[model samples]
Every structure is written in C-alpha cells, then in structure tokens.
Target: MDTIIIEGGSTRLKGQVTIEGAKNAVLPLLAATILPQEGKTLLRNVPILSDVFTMNNVVKGLNIALEFNQEKKEILVDATGDILDEAPYEYVSQMRASIVVLGPILARQGHAKVSMPGGCSIGSRPIDLHLKGLELMGAKISQVGGDITATAKKLKGANIYMDFPSVGATQNLMMAATLADGVTVIENAAREPEIVDLAVLLNKMGADVKGAGTETLIITGVERLHGAEHDVVQDRIEAGTFMIAAAMTSGDVLIKDAIWEHNRPLLAKLTEMGVEATEEADGIRIKSDLTKLKPVTVKTLPHPGFPTDMQAQFTALMAVVNGESTMIETVFENRFQHLEEMRRMGLHSEILRDTAIIHGGQDLQGAPVMSTDLRASAALILTGMVAKGQTKVTKLNHLDRGYYQFHEKLKALGAKIERVSEVEHV
Candidate 1:
C-alpha cells in the first residue's frame, strides 16, 4: 500500500502553486472528441492524471486514436470513426467520468453500450439524470446486468428540465444535444465553470450552444463538427484546497493561475474567518495571521454557491479553528467518510445525516489514517499538517486519480510530506 507521511505540529505552506488544467473539464472535453469526424481535436493544458489515462483508454476502445504528449501537457485525439458504441467494463470501471462518453458515442454511432462506471466511493451517484436527459433527446435507454445501452436513430432536440443541477448530467446532455436535430433547451442546468468550458469547446467544434454558466442552456443541432483547438480551464477545486490550507496554517501563499471569480464563495468564507486573500497578477494571494480563528457555518450548494468539492477540505480547515462550525453537505451523502479518518488525527466532530458539527481549537495527536476518496485524501493530508507528531495516510490510489504530483507541490511550499510505496513496521 502506498502511504503519504507527514511530520506535523508546526508547519506552514508558503509559496506559489501553479495549478494544472481541471480534471472535471478535461474529461468532458475528451468525450467531445466524438463530435468531430475530420482532423484531430487538439487539447492543451490537460492534466496528466490517472483518470485521464482511464478516459483515454475508454475512448481508444471505441476506435478513437489518441496520442498523449505528456511532455507538453497536450493530447491529440482522432475520433473520426465512432465505430464502436460499446464501452467495456475494464475501462469504464476505472473512472466514473467515463459515463460522459455515452452521450457523444450515442450521438455519433446512434448506439452505445457502456458498463456502469465505478470510481471513488464518495456516494451513490446515480446516472438516472443523465439517462433521463438523453431520453428526452431521443435516446432509447435500457439497462441489463449493470450494462446500460442507449440507442437513437437520429436524435431530435427537445425541451428538458433537470431535477438537480448535476454537472455530469449537464456535460453529457450538452454533448448529445450538439448533434440533435432541433433546438434543445436545458432548464435548471449546471452553472459550473466546467460546464461553460465544455460549451466553449462545443461551440468551437461547430455546436450552437448558449447560456453556459447559467441555469438555462440552449443548444441547436449542427450538421457536422470539425476539429478545433482548445485550452482546458484551471482547476478551481485545487486552488481552493491550497487557499484553505494556507489559511489554516497561518501562512502566506499565492495560488497562481487561479481565477478569483470562480471561487468567490470560498474566498468570502475565508475572509469572514479572518484570512486575507488579495487578487494579484493572474492569481490569488492568501495570508492568515497566527491567531485564534473565527468559526463560520457553511452549506454546500450548486455553482455561485459554495462548491461541494471544497467541502471536505473545508471541514479539515474547521477542525483547528477557534470555535464550533457546522457544515451541511447537500450534494453527496457519503462525503463525510473522511471525518472518520480525521478522528485518528484527533478531529472532533459529530455527524448527523448530511450535517457535521465540528469542535475546533484543540491540539490533535497524529495517528495512521486512511483516505476514502479523491478530495478526502487531500483533506486527510491537510489535517495531518496541523496534528502533533507524525501522521501516515494510506490508500492513496484515490489521490492519484485526480491530483497530479500533489505531494511534490506541497513539498515546494515547505510542508514535510512524502509519498512512499513501502511501510516499515516497528
């Protein structure tokens, strides 16, 4: 088992971090490869992560020839032939984001059979919303033996409404609607920045999409799409993680290439907690004074509200604050799994359904812990940074799925953290 070892008690993260392209954005962009039939879609600033590799394999299985230039952080995908509509269990089982490919696959091939995706055990993320939206766009959807098959003979656009603003559902339906016959209006759509990024690329690829970053999206079908070059968006979650960590440690750190507009909710909360965040040249600089911190109540919601992705990291930040803090997670059910792991590092909290009440302002003792998911892995590491003695976090496969060189980046900021493949028993 791979474990991250960190020496804690008195460490501060001080430096600038250059974030990579968003994993959330790049996955849907890769799925967009099925829209173009000629020339290669060139994607720049793609994050070199395990999930990216899994998605590439999934697309390759469907006959897309992909060449990954990791050195330049770019990928060239030729999805000229959307020949195979079957996404096997081997590839899709490795990443949940592989489900996004189903929309493009069905739009191009008129049929798609993909295995039910598997990834982090954060929650029971049902693909029902994705299927319902696709069905509205004229896809015949059925499931048998964990394999979902969607078939459509010339998809026709229609008015669709989402019960919830799911990011995955938005991306999938947006891609499917690009090749639809008439105007497809998606009401109550996701307003995440990643959604807007996908819309930007789809439009560049000849899709008539509008109203991104809003609750409503209108998409008109195009005859055929041509390959276009696009740069992936910066990861707002990664930048938020650093912002919380810098404030928790009372350190001065600048997160480079971070968009302040994308993280207004998090920045505002940090400000209420007495953290200083200033928008500088092309980045946000965060600084906190080494004093008692104010506790703030938070509730995770859709975009323009506090993001659910940042909730885990925020919980860890609240563990050492000056007062009690309450966090209500409205997005996923099982996200508080990391709070149990934090108990090993002396994080005091009471969990009641979707809400967690954290008791802060206490010295924590280090102990061995386990990572439950991608963001939870980051939260554990951040919690270990403030605990006394040495902390060891295992089950890092979840961490590698999203973050790229995470420990290396933290080390650059002067945190005593390292990842090792072996463990020495005492």
Candidate 2:
C-alpha cells in the first residue's frame, strides 16, 4: 500500500503548475480512435495517469497495436486491420471508460462484446443510457452472463434524447453514430468540452458532426473514417485542483496549458470566494489571500456546470474558510464519502441528503486519513497542506489514477509533502 505524508508547513505556497490534458476527455478520445480506418492516429499532450495506462491496456486487449513514446508523451494508435470486438470483463472492471469501446466497436465491426464496467465507488453509474441510446440507433443489445453483447448489422441513425446529459453516454453514442446510416441527432446532450474534443477528432477522421458544445448534437453517418492526428484539450479538472490547492494553502499559482473557457463555473465560484484569478491567453493565474477566504455554495451538475469530480477538492477549500458553506452533489450519491475522512482531519462537516454543510474557520489539525476514490485522495492531500499537524493519507493508488506527479507538483509549489512506501501503524 502507498501513503502520502504531509508535514504542516504553515508557509503560503507560491509557484506555477502546468495543467495536464483532461483525463475524462482523453480516455474517451482514445477509445474513439478505434473508429479510424487507416493511418496512425497521433495524440499529443496526453496525461500519463494510471487511468490512462489502464485505458491503454484495455485498447491493447482489443488487439489494436499502439506505439507510445513516454518521453514525448505521445501515442500512435494504429487501428488498421480487423480489430477485436470483445472487451473482456477483466479490463472493463478496472475502469468505467472501458465500456466506451462498445460504440466504436459496434460502429466499425457491426458487433461488440464488452464487459459491464466498474470504476470509482462514488455511485452507481449505470450504462442503461448507453445501451438505450444504442438500442434507439438500431443496435440489438443483450446481456449474456456478466457481459453486454451488442450487434448492429447496419446501424441507422435516429434521435437519441437522454433523460440526463450523461458524458459517457454522449461520447459512446456519438462514436457509434459515426458509421451509422442516415443522420443521428442527440438531444439534451452533454455540453462538456470533452464531447466537443471528441467531435473535433471525429470530424478530422471524416465524420460529419455539428452542434458540439451545445445541448443538441447532429452526426451524419460516414461510410469510413480515416485516422487523424489531434492534440487533447487541457484538463480543466487538473486546473481546478491546482486552483483549490492554491486557495487552501493561500498560495499564488499559475496554471499553464489550461483553457479558461472550460472552467467558467469553478472560476466564477473561486472569484466569489475572494480568490484573485486572472485569465490569460495561455492559461489562468490564481492567488489566494488567507484573510479573504469565505464560504460559498456549490451544486454539482453536468457539463458546462460544476463538475462532480471537483466537489471533494472544493470541500477541502471550504474547510478553512471563515463561514459556513454548502456543497450539493447532484451527480453521485456516495461522493460525500470524503467528508467522513475530512472529519478525521478536524473538518466540521455535516451530511444531509445530498448536501454537505461545512462549518469553516476551524484550524484543521492533520491526522491519518484514508482515500476512498481518485478525487477524494486529492482532497485529503489538499487538506493536509493547510492542516496544523502531520497528515498521512493512505491508499494513494486512487490519486495516481487521476493526477500525474501529485507530490512532485506540490513539492514544486513548496508544499511539505512526500510519498513514502512505509506505512505508520496507528
């Protein structure tokens, strides 16, 4: 087991951090590469996180040959020949994004056998929306044992309106609809920048997709899609995490390679809380004054809204604020699992239904805490930064799945943190 130990420094952190590519965006975009017929698809600015490696393994399991340059951080996915259509349970159980292969496989091969995916214990992220949308698009889907088998001799596009604009479902259906016959329209689609990023790649691959970054998406079926090179969009989650970290430590940090437009909601909230934020052409700069920290209300929503992934990190920021703040998590039921661990770190938080009421102003004294999920691990580390005593965060593997070089980046920001293999017996 890996653990992160943080010694309270009391010093304000000040530095610059380069935001990595969006993990949520990159995974699905990688899965979409399965649709390309010829030429090696080059993806640059990819984040080297555990989840990315897991997705890469899943892609490899499908027998799609890939050449990755670790130093350059580029992956060349060559999906030329007859690719494997089955995504075994072994790979899918590791990450939910593995289910994304269902659409691309069905689109290109006319059949797919994929395992139901499993990911963070945050909540029940059902794939019904994905299956239902594919069913609407003329795919015959069935469950055999623990796997989902979908077959579409020839997919004909139709209207797919989701009850909620699920990002996973939107990406799946968009890829599946690419090779579909006729026109496919997705109503109430996710407006996340990742969706647009995938659309941009698909268009470059010869698919006609329009109305991205909006509620409605229209895709015209193309017979074949050729491979194209594309650079992934910068991760807004990474940028938001750095922003919250800076705020928690009352630091000044510049996040380069971040898209300011993609982080409007978080930026707005951070600005409201008295965090000095400036948007530049390249990225955004965030500086926090400990004296001005204040409580604020945040409700998690879908794309173009407050992301659920950032909830835990923001909660840590609110822990040291001057007043009470409310965080409503509308995306996942178990997202507040971090609050229990936060309490162990001297945070005053109460969970009522989906809302967490945080009574701030307490000088957090760090204690041993366990990470429950990816974002939760980040929140714990952020809490450790401002806490008064030594903090040990166990189960750091979850943190590795998302953030690249967690402690290294914090160390560069002058944080007193270290990743040690030795575990302290409580």
Candidate 3:
C-alpha cells in the first residue's frame, strides 16, 4: 500500500503544465490494434499510466507482440499472426477496460472468451448493452465460471439500438461491426471524442465507418484491416483536473497539449463561475483570484456535454466556494463515494439521490482520507490542496492507475506533496 501526504501552501501557484494523451481514447484504440494485418500498428503520444500498462498486459496475454518505448512514449503492437482469443479473469478483474478485447478478438478470430468484469468506484456498469448488441450482430454469448464465451460462425450486420449511450458498449460494437457480413447501423450511440478517435484509426485501417461522433453510426463490412499509425488526443479529464487545482489554489496555470474543443463545456462553466480562462491555439490558461468562487450547478451527460469523470474534481472545487453548488451525476449512480471522505476533511455536503448539494465557504482542515476509485483519488488530492493543514490520502494505487506523475506534477506547481510506502501487516 502507498499513501500521499500533502502540506498546505498558502501561496498561489503560477506555472505551466503539459497534459498527456487521452487514457479513454488510448485504451480502446489499443484494443482495436488486434485487427491489424500487416506491419506494426504504432501509437504515439501515449500516456504513462497504470491503466495503459494493464491494457498492454491484456494485449500481451493474447500473444500479440508489443514494443513500448517509455522515453519516446510510443507503443508498437504487432497482431499480424494468430493470437489467443481468451482474456482471463486475472487481467480483466483489474480494470474494466479489459473487456474491450472481446470486440477485436471476436472480429478477428470469430470467437472470444473473456472474464466477467469486476466492480469499480462508480455504479454498476453492466455489459448487458454490449452483449445485447453483439447478439444482434449474430454472436452467441454465454457465461460459465465467470467467463463470457462469444462465438459466431459468421457475423452479419443488423440494425442495433442501444438502450443507453454507453461509451464502452458503443466502441465494442463498432469494432465488432467492422468485420460483419453487411452494413451495420448503431442508433443512439455514444458521441465521445474518444469514439471519434477510434473511428479515425479504423478508417485509416480500411474500415468504412461514417457518422462516428454522432448519434447514428454506419459501418460497411470490409475484407480485412491493415496496420496504421495514430496519435492519441489530449486527456480532457487531466486538463480539467489541473484547472480545478488552479482554482482551488487561487493560482494561474497554463495547460499545454489540451484540446479546447473537447473541453468547451467545462471551460464555459469555469468562466461562468468567474474563473479567468483563455483559450489559445496551443492550450488553455486558467487564473483564479483569491476571492471566493461563485457556486454553479453541473450535470454529467454524454460527450459534447459535461463528462462524469470530472464530477468528483469539480465537487472538490465546490467545497471552498462562496455559495451552494449542486452536482448531478447522471451517468453513474454511486459516484458520490468521495463525498463522505470529503466530509471528513471538514467540508459540508449532502447527497440527495444522485445529486450532491455542497455548502461551501468552510475552512477545511486536513484529515486522513481513503480513496475509493480513480477519480475520487484525484478529488481527495484536490481537497488536500486547499485544506488548512497536512492531509494524508491512502489507496494511492487507484490514483496511479489513471494520472501520470500526479504528485510530481503538483510539486512542479509548488505543491508540498510526497509519496511514502506503507508497511505491510503480517
């Protein structure tokens, strides 16, 4: 186990930080590499996060050769030969994104055996949507001993409509549809930029996909896909996390390599709350005055809307604001697990259904907090940033799973934080 210790700093932080590639985009795109048929599929600008490593392990488990260069931050995946079609529970239980292998494996090998995914910090992310979509595409799905076996003699395209716009389900089905017999249509699909990024990569690989960043997607079956190179988009969630940190510390920070278009909704809300934000061609800059921030309401929705991943960080920002702020997490029902931990820090908040009403303007005193999930770990660190004294956050492995160099990045911006290993219990 590991814990993070944060010492309160009264000075306003002023510096520039570079954002990394999108984790959400890179994970699915890595899974899509299973369809490549020629030279190595190269992915550049990859983030150095544990989730990436986990996904890479899952890929390697399938006998796909991969070469990763941490110095250049590039990954070369070779999948031109016969590959294993089974993703065991040992790998899939660590992260939910491991489920993505089902699509590519089924597409390339006509069968896949993947483990049932484990629980996460958020709500129950059922794969019923994914299994249902695959069934519509002529795949027979069954569960035995915590593994899902999907087999298809030949996949034929059909009209499929999602009950909900699930990002994972949409991406999985889209990849599976690429090798179907005929045209496939996905209605009420996810419109995240990550989905569009995958579509772009698939197109470069000779996949006929249209209207990817929209509600309806059209895909025509192709004989096979060839190798292609792609660079992942910047992580909007990381950018948003840094922006919230700047606001909490009354600092001025410039975040480079961030996509302003993908973060328009968050930036707009920050501006409406009186945080000074300017979008430049290179990146976006945020500056916060020492005055109390005005409260604002936020509701997480599908892409081209406010993302649910940022909800926890925004909740941390609301803890010290002037008035009341309400956060409605529409995507995940149990995402407010961090509120209780925040309350331990002397912050006042109440959860009503899926919404959290935060009464700000309290002087938060540092306290021991436990991280329940990846995003909640980020929120705990943000709370530590503005607390009155020293704060210790446990379960840092959750934080490492997503953010790269989290403590180092905060330290570069003048934060007093350090990572210390915990002693094992006999």
lDDT of 2 by residue, 1-426 (tens): 878889874957787888788898889989988998887799998989888888888888888998778788898999998789897677688998888989999999999999878889999999999999999999999998889999999899899999999999999999999999999999999999999999999999999999999999999999999989999898889889998998888898888867788889999999999999998776788999978877899999997789898999999889889899999999999999999998887888889999999999887888999999999999999899888889999988899989999899989999998887764543
For residues 209-258, could you state the per-residue lDDT of candidate 3 as single tens digits? 99999999999989899989999988999999999899888999999877
Q: Write the per-residue lDDT of candidate 1 for residues 1-426, one digit (tens) a residue.
A: 788999988989898999999999999999998779877899999999999999989888888799999999999988876468898689999888999999998998899999999998879999999999999887899999999999999899989999999999999999999998999999999999999999999999999999999999999998889899999999999999999889888889999999999999999999988899999987999999747579999999999899999999999889989789999999999999999989877788999999999998878888999988999999999988989999999888889888899999988998998888774522
Please state the error at residue 300 of candidate 3 in Å: 1.1
Compared with the true structure, all predictions reach lDDT values of 0.91, 0.90, 0.89
* CA lDDT, candidate 2, residue 193: 92
Model 2 scores worst on lDDT over the 10 consecutive residues at 417-426
- Candidate 2: pairs in clash: none
Provide the TM-score for each candidate, comma-separated: 0.98, 0.98, 0.97
Relative to the true structure, candidate 2 reaches a TM of 0.98
Off by over 4 Å in 3: 9-11, 290-292, 423-426
- Which one wins by lDDT: 1 or 2? 1
Error of 3 at 118 (Å): 2.1
In order of listing, the candidates' clash counts read: 0, 0, 0
